[model samples]
Target: MRDFHLLIDVGNTFLKWGLFQPSAAGGARENRLESGHALLEEIPALPAQFAKYPAPSRIVISNVAGTRVRAATIRVLEVWPDAPAPYWLVPQAEQCGVKNSYRNPAQLGADRWAALIGARWLLGPRAAMVVVCGTATTIDFLSADGVFKGGTIMPGVGLMLRSLHEGTAALPDQGGEFDEYPTQTVDAIASGCQHAQAGAIERMYAHEASHVRDLTCLVSGGAARAVTPRLAIPFQYHENLVLEGLYRVSMSL
Candidate 1:
């Protein structure tokens, strides 16, 4: 059996991973063979699935989940027989041809750093905004030349809903439909959350538009779809951006 390259992204509430196999032409092995995600609770089951395949030729990960999840992930990594050492990705001032703008690049989330790298690498010389709307919605800007200009972050759909419910006296923390005109309190809460997320994205996108022409907004993360539909600015969704970024980093090294 052909050996594989594994890519992992550990987010706040979920773990995302992708497997890449060698390509037919065998130049870059860029084609992703499989990918999946699991919420924090389901992570332990995640690594065990690796046994079905040959040991990965290499493993790379970008983790933002805190210590508990990291510890659990370590347990799973141990499951791969004779697997290569795992490469934990961190944000550097420059890597994979993307330049980071943070005063201290290491402070940026590894997931975001990967997304920026993946986005720029995928859409070379095309200026765009990278928005990841998961537990926290992050809006980062990329110049056409592959320079990462830092952006903003805010509460995502679920977090927005939770904050309102937890901060207030009566609103329940539950899912609701996004509506133009909500007749019920639940829909009102949901719609409000959507509006908040979409508005922040649009604002950042508009700011980017002010500086660049024909800007494309590249969005990802669990809540991305929920928030994208409500956005006034158009956006392209990339579910495996972080994973793709990890892949790119691996190729570079």
Candidate 2:
């Protein structure tokens, strides 16, 4: 079998992965093989899922879940001793065609960095706003010239709901249906949280539009479905966006 690359995106809520056959001429979409996600705690069991395929030639990872998850990821690689050392994605001043504008570039999350690269790879010179809704919501602006213009971090749908339930004594932990005017407390909480997410993205999009023409909005992550419907502007949903970015980074290496 041909050698392939393994890409992993470790977010705060889950560990997402993808297998890419770079030797394949079909580009990133066609290069992808088996891909799936598991909760952070399920990292140890990943080897079994990977066992069916031969050892990858390269393993690239973007981990924002912290040191413990990083250690767990390393341990999971014990199954493929022959695979080359994993290349952990660290934010730099510039990488993979995207320039990081963060005051301290290294402070940017690895997953977000990868997503920015993926957006550039997918969109070329187009201006875009990359919104990732997972444990947290991030709306980053990327210029047509490929410069990352920084973004906002806010509570995601789940985080907002969880916070409301935890912080308030009356609101329940579960979500209710979204409504223009929510009658029940649960529905009101759900609508407010989801709308908050959509509102932020819209505001960011409006801001980016004033400076850059023809902006594209890219949305991804687990909670994307819950928030996308509430969005008033146009958007393209990208599943496993961070994983795709990782693949793009691997290609540069």
Candidate 3:
């Protein structure tokens, strides 16, 4: 019998879902589908996205919010009423063939867990740095030995911009394209935010390299496209690392 997998990544602002059929090698199925929602309330509609495909035998979720986590659980149960309760992928000692390297493994963010798992799969067993820029920008370093060394978290592009406006008196609420170089104050704020994030990751990449060589940087998250082009170093973007990790976890069990 074929195995069906459902992967869900619930972030601060969005919930990303990926559906796949397990192949013989325990990798993703050939016909994969991806979708997402902005509101947590819309979670109940999740099953509709996979209605055309086969029902998933296993479900994996990585949720950041407790309330949303509860909501997601309910939604999944409602959708797969007949299936077993979905597995919540928390930061554990071992998962998806990767061992947790943190001192307190449980403290590691689920999103980070997904990134490390996806990074190992994408960059092989080599030392790698994964940068996820979204609601918050996180730069995680995975040693050459496949151990997750640690990572840094900072205000993301949108959060930084919103904070500047809310916290400051002179700065106005401004927005611009992240692709173009800034010419004016608004553009400057936009570019500054983008460059600052990209610069931080570049510096982190360099810092990680002082101890480990041949480090591969993998960038992902919603704001990945905005900051990726500004970085001085070469990196690969995985738009759905969390979702991909969830899929991998489902295959494991």
On lDDT, the candidate that comes out on top is 2
lDDT (tens digit, per residue) of candidate 3 on 1-253: 2556677788877777766776645444344644555556676666676456556687788888677566764665565556667788789987766778888898898988987887886677799888888889999888767788778899999898898889988776666665465677777788889889988998988888788878888889998887888999879877777777776777677
TM-score of each: 0.94, 0.96, 0.89
Local error of candidate 2 at 173, Å?
A: 1.4
The candidate that wins on TM-score is 2
Best first by TM-score, ranked: 2, 1, 3
Candidate 3 residue pairs in clash (backbone atoms < 3 Å): none
Ranked by TM-score, the better of candidates 1 and 3 is: 1
Give the candidate order by descending lDDT. Answer: 2, 1, 3
lDDT of 2 by residue, 59-142 (tens): 999999999999999988888878899999999999988999999999999989998998998899999999999999998989
lDDT of 1 by residue, 1-253 (tens): 5777888899998888888864443222257777778888998796568767777888898999888888888788888757888899989999988999999999999999999988987788999899888899888999888899888778888888888899999998896798999999999999998988888788777777887997989988888888878888787888767877887887776
lDDT agreement with native, every candidate? 0.84, 0.89, 0.77
TM-score of 1: 0.94
- The ten-residue window of minimal lDDT in model 2 covers 21-30
Comparing 1 with 2 on TM-score, the higher-scoring candidate is 2
